[model samples]
Every structure is written in C-alpha cells, then in structure tokens.
Target: MAAPLSTRPVTMVSPFVAGGTNDLLCRLLAENMGKSLGTTFVVDNRAGANGNIGTAFVAKQPPDGQTLLMGNSATHGTNPTLYPNQPFDALKDFAPVCMVAAVPVVLAVSTELGINSVADLIAYAKKNPGKLAFGSSGIGGSGHLCGEIFKTATKLDMVHVPYKGDVPAIQEVMGGQLALAFVGVGPATVGIKSGKVKALAVASSRRASTLPDVHTVEEAGYKGVEVTQWYGLFARSGSPKDMLDRMSAAAKEALAKEEVREKMLTQSIEPTYLPADELNVFYRNEIKRFREVIQRLNIKVT
Candidate 1:
C-alpha cells in the first residue's frame, strides 16, 4: 500500500469504461468513501490494455495514500500468467485493500449449434473432433481458462480463439462467427436473454441468480473447475496501515449496505468483504491455482 500522507483528495483509478460492473462499483465505493471520510474520493477512468493500462499506472504512482487502484481479474489473477513480462507485480507492488466481489463466467453456445447442454456439446465435440471452435475475451482471461478447462476435462479436440474483449467475443458467438464461448455472465446474459445464445453451464460452484436455468460445471460433470472473475482494491506497497485500515473498513461497510448488496446480487456478483489477512490467503490460493492451470495447459503468453 502507499505511504501515509496528509488529508488530501484520493484519486481512485478504474481500469474499465464507465457502465461496466467494475466502473459502477468503483464509483459507488468512491461516493460512499467520500461521504464516510468527509473528503473527496475521485474516480478516474483509465481504460485500455484489458485493464493493464490503469493498473500499471496505479502501480507506478506515488507510494502515498492519495492514489488507489481498483483492480479486477484481468489485472490481478489472469494478467500474471497471460503476460510473461508484465512490468508490475500484482501481489508485491500493490497492498491489498479489500476483495469486492466474485464475477461468474457463463458457458454459452450459439443457437444454430443445436447444443442445449454441456453433455450435448461434449457429445458433438467427440463426434466432430477439430471442427468446433470456441472463443474467449483473450488468451488468459477467465473465459479463456474456462474454455481450456472444459476442453481438457471433456477431452475435446476443438480449437480455441481469443478476442480482445468480452463484447466482441460474445457478439461473434451470437453472430455465428463462433460456435461457443465462456464469458462474464453480465454480457452473456444479454445474448441469452435475446435468444441468440444458449446457456449450457456456469463456471461457478452454484448456479447464477441471473440465469437460474443454467447449471454449474460440476453439475455438467466437470467438478473442481470452478473459476470466478474477481475484483478488488489496492494501493502501492508500503502504504500506511492506518490508511489501508480506513479504506478496508469503508469498503466492508459499503459492501454490507443493503442497497449495494442487492445491486451486486442482481448482477449475480457474490460479495466478499475480506480484510487484509484473509484477502492475502485468498490471493495466494488463487495464484497457486493459476500456476497449476498454466502448467497443465503449457500456456505462455507472448
């Protein structure tokens, strides 16, 4: 975390465009934090490089408590393995503030594929071999990992395609440019609702509230493959303990608010308000899990 500083405006950077869940949550937390602390907490949009642009910017910011990083899965969990030469360290360069929520990924297929369930997809893949193709947001995103995990679990020989962002990947699947994809439920839900895509399963342990009809990967016969896109807050390493404590407390309070809880629930994001100690434990386990997956897949990002 950043070093202690006198009471000054805190500049919070979100690594996504406005209207996304990350952007929305950051704004909400900033507004609430500002109110609670009786000081301004400004949110700046630094969208690019699949969240790395803003995250790296915050990592290199002054080690004072004035700058905060609203980090998500792309920056924390996925980027570590995806970018072999990433300039900043997700764990070392940043002090853990709090874990905001877990965003689940949905396994969806185009309606034209005539696949309604995971079993159906697996059966078809078995028969078709390398004919089927799956797309994801990028090479090392939760969506990409989900598809790779599915391929390994089902012993399918389909191809993997990576796109720059979730919207384009999901849209391609909807437009028949691809057969299927695993995407964040927020964007996938729209296509599913429109009847353009069919939901097979989710990569979470339990079913998503947004799509109760869909089953979990375990239910689809792939156990121990649960993965969720998570979001959290961080500051430069060595940030004052008092400032970290204050931010963590404010985050916990904001997450516990009835309105915040309900809104997150509506978006199918499970709230996880973790203090520093517990958050570190969670991050360690996630890093380990990512390492195993990368080794198993022999994945190396350029």
Candidate 2:
C-alpha cells in the first residue's frame, strides 16, 4: 500500500499568471477544498510558457498527493499539440481529481464597429475579406482556435493578431483596434456589462447563463464552432489511489457548496463537477480533440 500523505499544507500550482480566470478559479476551489480536507491548500503561481512551466513542475513532484495542479484546457489539452516538443505528457504525468467547471468562449466585437450579431460580423468580414482583424491571447489558445473555427465555418477571410494575453486582446477589441475577439466568459461578462464590448455569439452549444441574451454560434446559423474552456484538478500520476479519491471527493464537496456555486456563476463560470473516473476520460478526449483542431488549423508555437 502507498504511504499516507504528509500533513504538510498541500500546494496547488496555478500555471497561468495571477489575476487571470485560471488563478481566480484555483484560489476559490483551493480555499474550499482546504476547509473540507482539514489542511491548508495554498495556490502557488508558477506562470510561464503558456502554463507549461508550472504543469511540468507538478509532473516532476513526488506523487504524495500534497502537490497538486490546477489544470485548464490549454495546459492539458491544447498545449500538447501546439508545442511539438512538450516537456511533459499531460495524460501520463497526472492523475485526474475532478473537473471544476467549464466556461464558454464569447465572440465580442467593438461596439463602435456597429456589429450587433454574428451574422452582421460575418457579412462584414465577407465583404472586407482580409481587412477584418481579430485578436487572441496567443496563436494556439482556445480563443485563437475559436477564431480559426469561425473563419473556416463561415468561409470568411480575416487577419489574426496574436497578443500576449486575453486582457490586452479584449482591450484592443474594445478600443476598436481590432474587429473582434474570442474571449472567455469571465472577462467577456465584465466587458459586456460595462458596455465596452458587445457579445455577438457565445461559442458553446447553449447560451451562457451569465449572458442569457447572447445567442449561441449555432443558434446564429453557424454550426460546429463550439469551444469551452474547462478547469480541473490533478495530482502526480504515481499518487496513491486512495489519496486521489480523497482529494477528488473533497473537490466535489467543495464544488457542491452553495457559496462556491454562486461565486463561480458570478464569475461567468458554469459549475459542473465530474468525478475522477469520468474526468480522466474527458481529459483524454479533450487532448485528442484539441490535437485534431491544431492539426486542422496548422497551429504551432514553434
């Protein structure tokens, strides 16, 4: 039998930079899980290389269940395909804990562009061709893929401008420097509510609860453009099964809290928990799906 985990405080690594949605979600979940586990769960921001640095760090750590990773779609799903020589294998290096939540990607346009809906934007792009420009957090990010999917499905020609991060990309769109952007629901919610940007359509099968008035891409006559960024918890692969189960159960209990649900909803993240067994399958599928998307779009970091 595997040895019991140490009583030391668990360290949950957030690969993305601080103040982003990933960090916020990690902290929120860690705080609640800490309470349930009777141990302090601390978030350590190890942001770099589009989350590769932190994720790889966790992969190398001993599987005592004390070192955890707060992984997102980009870290565990898209990066493997985006980076040809990834330092670590997402599927092989980690043990699934539980899925935290999924947030929809929203296509937001500058209000000054006078584009009120996805149809309007598509029509404009078709007319202007390569003149319409869209920005993303990076070349191979979920937002970037959403833009590429939009381009493919709509048969529109638009230029892609890659930014260092989503905040700058969304800001440029709001400033009318770019035609539009595919942003995560959290930032998109704030932008929409502030009237700084107008959401054309959300790239999910169903409309987001935070933005109920916005139409989905399919509802707007554009099918097969769905992209949702999901977050999950993980531990090193060699961790004890019992320890993994305990952590997964704690995660589920934390997610089940009314306050936690409200907080996630307030941040435009839909709380949907999947246990370890189901999440492992979901994680593998996400990796495969993103790999196909990257191959189809010829997306690569280097």
Candidate 3:
C-alpha cells in the first residue's frame, strides 16, 4: 500500500461553480479521500468560461500531488473545439488520476411548456417554428454538448442559450425563463422532485437513479442522443509517479466506500472508477469523439 502523497493537505480544483455535479463530486471525494489517505483535502471552486478558468488555474499549479483537479467531460472533451485559445491542453497539462463518476443528462422542461415526453417536445418545437431556444451551463459544458447532440439527433433547429452553471439553467426551466435545459441529473434533481420541472428523457443509456421514472433517450426513441457527463481526477503533469499512484489509490479507496457510493447514487451520479492509465485512454477517446461531434454538428462558439 502506498502512503498519502504529501505531508500537507491536498487541494482538488473543481472547474465549475458550487451547486453543480462537478462541485458536488469534488467535495464528496475531497472529504472521503482525505479520510482514507490520512491527509486533509480542500476543494477550490473555480468557475467561468465553461470551466476554462479553473482548468487553466490548475494546469499552472505545481505538480507535487498536493494539487489535483476534478476534470470532467466539458474540460477534457469539448473544450478544445469550443475555445480556440484555451490556455491548457486537456490531454497534455494533467496526469490522469482516476475517473470518479458519470451523471446522465436530462432534457427537462418547465411544466408550463406542456411537454410531457421527448416526442411532445419535438412536436411543440416544430409548431413554435422560429428557432425554439434551449439553455445550458455554458458553451462547452456537458449540458451544451448534450443539447447539441439532442438537437442533431432530432433534426431540430433550436437556439442555444448559455447560463453560468447547471443550477441557473435548471432555475430558468423551473421559472419558465427558457423552454428547457439539458442538465446533469444531480443539479436538476431538486427541481425534478419538486415538480417545478419535469424530465422528458435522460440522455444516457440508463435511467438515472435519482430520477428513476424518467425514460432514457433510447427508451424515448432517440438512441444517438444518449450521452453522459463524466467527471475524473487529475493532477498537474510531471507529478511524481509514486505520488500519482498514491492519489489514485486513495481516490479508489474513497469510491469503494459504500456510503460514498450511496450518496452519489442518490444524487443521480453513478460512481464509475477507472485507474489512471485506463482513464487516460478513456479521456483521449472521448476527446476524439467530441471533436468529431463538434465538427459534425458545426458547433461553433457564439
């Protein structure tokens, strides 16, 4: 068994704001990993520019294993295409720690929309005619990507509206500020349960545990629209191999705990762990797929 990487507390940078799934998982792992590794872990929230601000901040940190980043599908997957001058290279600036969890994306609408299912939403959009608008966290965030995927799959010409984070988007949906939002299950859970907003379909292969009654994209008859927002741990590149291993080991330990797993599941976040090397491969593959999708969909920055 490897020892904890540092004598000092570790800082895990979450590249989004506080109420979203990324921040939620970041705090969860920080607390549990600290316990398992015998060191304190601090969570730093760096939000803005669709996760580029905090991601760039982490990329500049010292590679001593004391500073880790909680990266996700937005930073690693869609950012390259979304930000032409993004400061850090998602693949090159960080050493893979492990993949932490994946959350389904929900196409949720305000009850005011009178859209009860994916099919109804489509017909409503068609009837509305002049560019039905949709909301997301930001341009490159997972919600934005999921919206693009859903739009392409359904062949709907809709406008994209970017919010600061998932909570804001969901809030807008509940307030009827926007027609709907494609958001992660975690941040949308509260509104979904409150009945202020209702999910039309989950944009993943499986239904979300937090919203078990919601049908999946495939179940709603749109298989190509299935996508999940994945989160993972990463350290500044060139961190000591042993330190990286220790961090990976500690994160794995945290994820293996039953309490942590249950908390994540209840939030509609699925705990999916992958070792460092495997996670690196997964990140690269996801990045490639994202690049292809962005091009295929002509997803240009606004």
Candidate 4:
C-alpha cells in the first residue's frame, strides 16, 4: 500500500501556454487525479521560453510532492541538446513522477494542395525542390523532428517554418502559406475533419486512432521515420519515494477510468501510464535517444 500524500493542494505546472496539448493533458490529469487522490490539483499555466521558463520555476521548488510539473518531449527530451545552457538540468533538477500520455505527430497539409498521400507529397517536393516549406509548432518540437526525419528519409528539400503553436501552423497550412505541417493529431484532428486540412501520414509505427484511415509513415514506405511526443508528470529531485509512489498510484488509478481513456482518445492522446521507476527509465532513454538524433542531424537553435 502507498503512504499518504501531502495534504496541501497540489499545483500541476504547465510549461506551455493554455489551449495547447500539454495544457489540455494537464487539466485532464489534474481533474481526474484530484478526484482519485482526494486532493485538489490545480493547473498553473506558466508559459514562455519554449517551456524553460516554467520548467526552471518548478526545478527550484521544494523537494516535496506538493508542486508537480507537466513535462513533455520538448522540455525533457530535445531541449537538453538544443538549449544546452539552460539554468536547470533536465535529469538532475527534477525526478520523473509518472508518464501520462503519448501523442503521435501527423503530417497535415492544406486541402488546397490536392495532395492525397505521402507519395504525392514526395513527388511534389521532388518536382518543386526547394520550393516546398513545412511548418511546425517550433524548432526542436516533435513536429520539427518528425519533419526532419521525413525529409532525411525521403531526401527532400522542404524548408522549415516555426510557429508559436500547432494551431497557427495548421492555419498557415490551411492558408497555403506552408505546404504542410507536422503536428500532433489533437490539434490537427478538427481541421482534418472540417476539410480545412488533410492528413497524409501519421509519423508513428501504427495508425493513430484519431485518424485511422491515414496510414503510418512506415506504411507509406518511409520505414524508421516513426516519431512521437509524450507528456508526463515531474517533481523536484530528491522527493520521497513513498510520495512519488502514492502520486504514481493516483495517476494510474485515474488513467484506468474508462471515461478518462475515452476522453484522452478523443483528444488524440493514448493513455500511457507508467510508474515512477519505469518513467525514470523512459525519460532517460528519451533524452539519450533525442540527443543522438539531434547531434547526428547537426540540428542547432540560434
């Protein structure tokens, strides 16, 4: 049995702006976990610096489990390599509490382009050469990484445009400002359903439930181009093991609810709950994996 959690109200810090994937997941988890744990979990949006500002804030908090962070791929995975001079160390400054969800990136294009599939996109890019441009939520974001992976695998010359968020990037694609965008299915699902944008491929090994008709990149013959962005919980380093264990239990319990599962699926997130120890391994592997990919690709942010 797990020990008692802090009686104080817990705050789940979201390092990104409201209305984003992280924010949505944070609110969802906060509400569900609050009910399961019988404690208040408030979502605090502290957006800026590509998630560093808020993450740095949380890193300095006390080692008690009262304050939690909703960390995602950018803050914990690619940022370590892309922004090496951050005030907080991704690994040393915080401890993994639990992994909440995983979202597959999608290839969204403007419906005006008449492109129907990944093959069509490749052929168009080949004909246009450097004329094509793709947008992402930001540089080093999962969307950008997926675009880079796709470009490298297919040997295409599509320029990258960074946007403030996926919605804006998809808006650009809808307006034909960008040929396509590699974005999370959560934000892209609405546009795809409305005919404002079309999804050519899901950048995962398997098809996304949100867009089951869209084939995976591997299915489109671009094997090994699989990419995903995951969201998880974190607390300051050196937090008590029992506290972490109780927190993990509450999270897993909330995740086990079928209503929660359905809601998460509707948002294009897979309810992937991992305990603290397992999340530690998962987080470390992600950082290491992304580091290798960033270094080999010679990706830099200036």
lDDT of each: 0.83, 0.85, 0.85, 0.87
Model 1 lDDT, residue 204, Cα: 88
TM-score of 1: 0.88
Residues 1-302 of candidate 2: C-alpha lDDT, one tens digit per residue: 43324478889999988987788888998788777777788899999988899999999999888898989888888888776577688879899888889999899998987889878897788788789988887888889998888888898898889987778888887777887888888777667777879998999988898889999999999888988898888999988888778778878888889998898898788887889889899889878877887898677685
Report the lDDT tens digits of candidate 4 across residue range 19-43: 8778988888888877767788899
Q: Tens digits of per-residue lDDT for model 3 on 197-243? A: 98888888778777788899899887778677889999899998887
Q: At residue 236, what lDDT does model 1 achieve? A: 93
Can you list the residue pairs that collide in candidate 2? Answer: none
RMSD of 1: 3.3
TM-score of each: 0.88, 0.91, 0.84, 0.90
What's the TM for model 3?
A: 0.84
The residue ranges of model 4 lying beyond 4 angstroms of the native Cα positions read 1-4, 296-302
Model 1 residue 24 CA deviation (Å) reads: 1.9
Which candidate wins on TM-score? 2
Q: Compared with the true structure, what per-residue lDDT tens digits does model 1 show for residues 1-302?
A: 43333468899899889888788888888888777776689999999877888988998987877888888766877677766476888878999888888878888899988998888998898888899998888777788888887787888897889998788988998898899988988879878877899989989878887778889999988887788898888899988888888888888888889888888887767777778777777776777788778778887664
Q: Candidates sorted by lDDT, descending order?
A: 4, 2, 3, 1
Better of 1 and 2 by lDDT: 2
